[model samples]
Target: MTTADDFRALHERPEPFLLPNPWDAGTARLLAHLGFPALATTSLGVANVVGRTRATRAEILANVREIAEATPLPVNADLENGFADDPAEAAQMIAEAADAGAVGASIEDHTGDRATPIYEFGLAVDRVRAAVETARQRSVVLTARCENLWLGVNDLSDTIKRLQAFEEAGADVLYAPGLRTLEEIRAVVSSVGKPVNVVMGFADPSITLEQLAEAGVRRISIGAALSRLALKSFVDGAREMLAGRFGFVGELPPITELQQAFD
Candidate 1:
């Protein structure tokens, strides 16, 4: 098995790669079969699958282990907020995630609020530093995410400042989820010397893989977009059937293919 050290070494390349996030073992294996170099666990997808409002500390670690065992490709855990209220507990959670065979993990600085929510810049940097220190014994890569985009803080300069601090704090990758502008993307890449991970979910994934590479992003992840697409298919199929319309059924993937894939 390739260790996390091996994965970390690959991130130094100038050209970036996409690290698509998958929800389950089957999805992970299929992506590996399709030639993706690595896969990340989607927190929203797993949390929805387990029927939990949000994935708990135990749930996230357990999911990482299960998915890691299912494939040989490197797995990066989307460990939401490190599953802790404080820096100490957050560090412990990062250690546990690394032990579960994760090559990398992401910690976001958002508090799930619409107004006045995110952690102060200093505190957020401390959390990333603590997480990196905890994973020092392991070879896990730590990504520090600033949710200023989602929080409606549209200033790219502020985002760059936060990412710069995270880089100084030992974060291997810096991510800003909702920044779709080329200017902002370029600014972030220039602000942090480490690799950058961008989420490609909006209608038009604004930046292409080539454009992102030129802008200096090292990784791209489609967070929950695939799962949502799958769910939309199910809902559309059901609605068609309820309306006595069988025409849309053929648009779905062949049942045999799904069955054989699982087999």
Candidate 2:
């Protein structure tokens, strides 16, 4: 089966599968070595790759290629907002992402403007529909994300409404990333017929994978959580260096263990 086919099938199971995001090829290989079934590119993580606040199309797709080629596992590209305000641009971005080796990708509704963070409802759904057409041709599993809940818009009803429209637009998966409670998550799941992907990075750590699955989540992703964790460790270790100490060394895995994991 194709990578896209494999990726789509992963959403069929009862339990929610963890879709970990890797920042680059090394992290991608490590994740594959650690036995993750799939990997994804994080837009913020990719920015860390080029030492920029946000990455350009060329940079994003180059990172996508590197991560996808690092391991045999399918890679989902986080093509945030499809990189443009126009629906055509979003469609083009999906096509380009597939060519770069992503079998699955996401298109969020966040406009780049802070003054108007979310796209108008009509334009948002139209963008999704445009992306769906391209995804259909490439057999990429497209997850339509509503940024309202994640972006401080505390309106669940509108979020559900947007996701429902996205589902009807032929998106394979639906996501509203900032849900905090199980009730909110379940309500989103119950609102749509397509598979729902939840980002555990935004939820309480106390919430287990089982609880999310029980709440009817199909796919659970850690968007930039792993990247942020790696950053924290680096910062903590750097502080130790400034303090003239080697104590943090004991916290890391043995070199041999890391070598074997890479091998």
Candidate 3:
């Protein structure tokens, strides 16, 4: 299968595939070595690495190109809000991402303003349509994300309606982050009829993979959770060193092992 087909097939599996989000080339290579079928770049993770509140399109595209070239597995970019308020500009950015070697990408409906968090319904659908049409030209998988749930909208019906519109707008995958219940997850998955991606880690820790699969989720991603975990380790180590303790050094992976993975 082609790279695009291979990435698309991961969502078609009977069991939901785990798509870990990696922030950089090192993390991408390490995750690929661990045998994940595909990797998605975390916008938060990349922002943290670059010390930016949010990464620019140029920054994200550079990271995407690096990770895509660093591993054989397909890489999906978190192209948050398509980096533009205009639909045509958003569509052009999607095409640029495809040209940078991302087999898959996501466009979210978040409006970047907490007071008016999500885009208006019609405009959101138009944005997804624009992104999808551009992605289709490059044979890229486009995942349309409805930010309602995460933006405090808390309306499952509205979220599902947006997802349905996105599906009809030609999104290959549907995602509504912050869905907490099995019923909520299943509702969106059933309503969309396309592959549904659920973001894990922020949800209840007790929810198992099987539970999500049973809810009909087609793919799972841990958006920035891994990056946060890594940062926690570093912070803890630094704290111990400041206290004159050296024990944290013992917890690190051997340099040779990291070198081998990178090689």
Candidate 4:
């Protein structure tokens, strides 16, 4: 089966699957070796590594290409805002990402400006429609996202409204990244017929995989959570080194395991 077909089927399965986000080729391969069926690129994780608040389009696509090439697992590119305000420009990112070997992709309704965090309703829906057209041509599973909760707007009503519009616009999967509670997730899931994706980082840690699947979540992703945890470990170790302590080195395991994953 094609990668797109494989990825689309994962969302159709009875139980929810975890889609881990990797920032680079190495991490992508590592996650694949660890047995994930699919992988996603984390935009913020890339920004952190590149030393920018957000990496440029060229940088993001290069990273996508690298990760897609690194593993056999289906890859979902996080084409943030499609890197443009114009609908056509936004949709072009999907074509490039497909060319980069991504079987799936996401376009969020977030405007880069803090003052007006979301695109106006009409424009947002239009952009998603344009993207859906291109995604269909490319055979990519297009995920349309509502940024209200992700940006701290705390409006479930608006989130559901936008996702429904995107579902009507032909988005294969619907996502709202910052939902904090299962109640909100259930509300969104019940309002739409398409599969719903929830970011685990935004939800309560106590919530188990069974609970999410039972609540009608078909896909579960941890956006930048693992990458952030890796960074935390690095920072903590670096601090220990700065304090003239050599004890952290003693905690290291043999490099064989990581090397085996690379092999």
Q: Can you rank all candidates by TM-score, best first?
A: 4, 2, 3, 1
Model 4 residue 3 lDDT?
87
Task: Provide the lDDT at 169 for model 4.
Answer: 94
TM-score on alpha carbons, each prediction: 0.92, 0.97, 0.97, 0.98
Model 4, span 105-192: residue lDDT tens: 9999999889999999999999999999999999999999999987889888999999999999999999998887888889999999
Q: 139-245 in candidate 2: lDDT tens per residue?
A: 89999999998789999999999999999999999999898889999999998999999998898778998898888899989888898899889999999999999
Off by over 4 Å in 2: none
lDDT of 3 at 138: 90
TM-score winner, 3 or 4: 4
Instruction: For candidate 1, write residues 1-263 as lDDT tens digits.
Output: 35686678668877888788788888887787778888899888888787665777788888899889888888899888876658878778777888898988888888655475688887888888888887666778888999888667877788889999999988888999888777778888887788888788741465688888888888888988898887788788889889989887567678776565455
Q: Write the per-residue lDDT of candidate 3 for residues 62-90, one digit (tens) a residue.
A: 88898899998998989999888788888
Residue 227, model 1: lDDT of 81
Residue 99 in candidate 2, Cα distance off native in Å: 0.4
Summing lDDT over every window of 10 consecutive residues in candidate 3, give the lowest-scoring window. Answer: 198-207
Ranking of all predicted structures according to lDDT, beginning with the best and ending with the worst:
4, 2, 3, 1
lDDT of 2 at 239: 95
Compared with the true structure, the alpha-carbon lDDT of candidate 1 equals 0.82
Highest lDDT: give the candidate number: 4
The Cα error of candidate 1 at residue 229, in Å, is: 0.9
